[model samples]
Target: MDLTVIWAAIIALGLFMYIALDGFDLGIGIIFPFFPDDSERDLMMHSVAPVWDGNETWLVLGGAALYGAFPAVYSIVLSSLYLPISFMLVCLIFRGVSFEVRGKANRTKNLWNLSFILGSAGATFFQGVVLGAYLQGIPVKNGVFFGDAFFWVTPFSFFTGMGLLITYSLLGASFLVIKTEGDLQRRMHGLIWPLTLVLIGFILVVTLWTPMTDPHAASRWFDSPARFLLYPVPILVIVVATFMFNAMRHQHDSMAFLLTIILVFLGYIGLLFSIWPYAIPGAITLWDAAAPRSSQVFLLVGAVVIIPIIIAYTTAGYWIFRGKAEASTHY
Candidate 1:
């Protein structure tokens, strides 16, 4: 395989892993506030606590690969996405702090809960904006992300943020099904049908709007043979979503959550397929943005050593903690 292609695949795989792994944790954070009581919320938080921090390993790896393998794309994306990224990072910091402080604090479960909700919502919104901005394309010229603070501002970004908020919340709810039982499980299963509908609405609106929002992307989707092949992505999303809805309605939370996750995964793949060569979509192709092969190979050795260690530790931690979560004080 070509080095550039190989490197691109690594980046994509890393990103997919980030979404699949960190996704449910982020979903847990998003859904934290939605549960009816503090105990249920605590259960949700505990389920993710063991692996949540380690889940970020994929992000770190992806960032490293982007910097090492595709420097130019990294520069453009980071430049354009700086504000949202900063906001998201701050929310993450506060959220992580809340996790520790809540355990230590003698009182004020209310305050900690507030922190958790705000942190989750803020992080999720920023992530959505970043996705929207990436798809909509930044106003870059001659290798710059342009100057306006509003460069990333748009209606599409707004919808994207909302969509992901629902999407991840559903993911969290799905997890609740898998991890909890009794009243909590019933409530979580209650979430599936409505959330599934909302997600569908989001997809419909985005599909209609992306054309008007980014014609270049619209061209790729609306144009001939490419367009025809692309239909299956949305079809799969719909099919999986429908199946999840049925499962959830029937009280099969585990299967419901798993299938919903599969839907999101396919949607992610579709997004990647839509813009394969361009790291920044309309900005730089992977090869043009690629670093030297020697550097990538050097990093690959370190990655091989590091990634497995992280995975093993993460797996072990989860296994140690695994079971129906019961609400309690800090870890």
Candidate 2:
């Protein structure tokens, strides 16, 4: 068996899980300003409070897996992107603290609310910057990151940062549609179509921009035989977007959220296809960056035992907390 491929799959699964689970909660913070009423904010926080912290487990799993399974890529990427990565971590710290303190504070609730918004937006923006920087290809030579710290601060990276903000806001809104009712649900439902339109616009920009600027990506999309397989992704995205629009129009709450998830998945697939086989895009293949075979075997054993347990508990948490959030509930 190719342990490198297996490990790569595991890391991909872990990252996608993180995006799917944690994206909405961080998104709640991004859209917090839209619903300025304190009570409505309470309900929004309550909807995600139970599972929000747990949603980050996949992030931990993904980072650890990368360190163990592909140490070279981990070290090089982290070192090169340290500034944005550090900023993202700091923002998450503020966001997590606000999540806990806002529920209890009587007078300082507004302060915490501000903290939450800044934290979420900062973390998400930097995440998109990091992603864009990675996609544009890290500067590497002889297995080391050779670029200066500000290499990630380009226009494309900032555009990606803004794009992620919209994406997560949409996720947050659709999730609220699932977890609230009455005026809050109505407002969220109202926001869905506009957010979807905005998201589609960002998607179109990225689709065109990536190929226009990156020769490798352009070749992958236009020249490779794999293009045949890749062609269905955008079509599926359109189909999913259409379904999501209809679901929102008809007020199919659960279906809207599910379709939104599908929309995100299709986008994720496109990204993976764009960077297939390359851990550092043009620089390094997964096999070239993979850790020793013995190390992977050991890590695989632990991952096998741990991943299922995490899945079981995460599933239980969601199931137990299912249904519309109550204003009286505090979490």
Candidate 3:
């Protein structure tokens, strides 16, 4: 296999880690507006506070890998996604700061809370928009970006943003059900069904729309060889979703959460499969956008040494902090 393909897989893995790790915390932020009670919010904040910063490490790794291994892809994406990415970064800044500032400000606790919620929701929405834009396609000409600055701003993109908000809320609620107890757990349980339904609706829409909108994607799944590869994906998704619902119904909170994560993972695998060989989704192939082989080799060297360390760090951190969070458990 080419170094380009190897690096692409690495970056994809990193992105998935970021989504599965930081995603629930971002989901927590998205659901912040629903719970008006200060004590409940505190518990929610405490649930994510210990690990939020570390969770973002995967994002940095993913971006860095993309930039180092495929400068052309990075440049094109940076140009096309400049505005939304900038806004997302600002939201992340506020969201991160709110975690630190919330505990310190007695008088302005509400303000910080608002910051956290808006930042989380805003960042999550824009991220979905970015994903939508990629699904639709990034306009490029001969390996160069040619789309307008606001090309990502579209009806489909906004629809995706809304869908992600619901999806994250579902994830956040499921996580709370696992990490909390009593009234909070019950409240999350009550919210899970509707959120699960909404997420399923979004998934259905994307599943249908993705194949219909892109001929390449359609053939990738429906054609013979790739078809065999992908045929089980939807079936697996259905099974996982069903299991999640059954677990939720039985108040198996941990099982429900695990199934939800599996469901998301299956969806991600399907997406990556549909867009295989393309880094920018129908625009740039992995080889075409790859940087020099020397650069890839250099980066691969560091990645080989550093990636394991990061994995160890993340695993140890989670292991150390594994327990149900309480309202008094402030970072």
The lDDT for every candidate, in the order shown, is 0.79, 0.92, 0.88
The runs of at least 3 residues in candidate 3 whose Cα sits more than 4 Å from the true structure, single-residue gaps closed, are: none
Off by over 4 Å in 1: 224-226
Best by lDDT: 2
Candidate 3 per-residue C-alpha lDDT over 52-79 given as tens digits, one digit per residue, 9 for 90 to 100: 9999999999999988999998898899
Checking candidate 1 for backbone clashes, the offending pairs are none
Name the lDDT value of residue 21 in candidate 1: 75
Best by TM-score: 2
Q: State the local distance difference test value for candidate 3.
A: 0.88
Choose 1 or 2, whichever is better by lDDT.
2
Better of 1 and 3 by lDDT: 3
- Candidate 2, residues 142-216: lDDT per residue as tens digits? 999999889999999999999999888988999999899999999999988898889888888988998887788
Per-residue alpha-carbon lDDT of model 1 for 1-331, expressed as tens digits? 5888887888787877777777777888777766657667777888787777887888888888888888888888888789998998999888888877776565787788778778878888888999998888777778667767777888889789989888888778887788889988898888878888898788778878877766667777777466777788877877887787679768984798688768787777667766766777777777777888898788778878887887788789878877777677356
- The TM-score of candidate 1 is 0.93
lDDT of 3 at 185: 94
Per-residue error (Å), model 2, residue 173: 0.6
| Clash statistics: count for each candidate | 0, 0, 0
Report each candidate's C-alpha RMSD, comma-separated, in the order given.
1.9, 0.8, 1.3
| Poorest lDDT segment (10 consecutive residues) of candidate 2 | 255-264
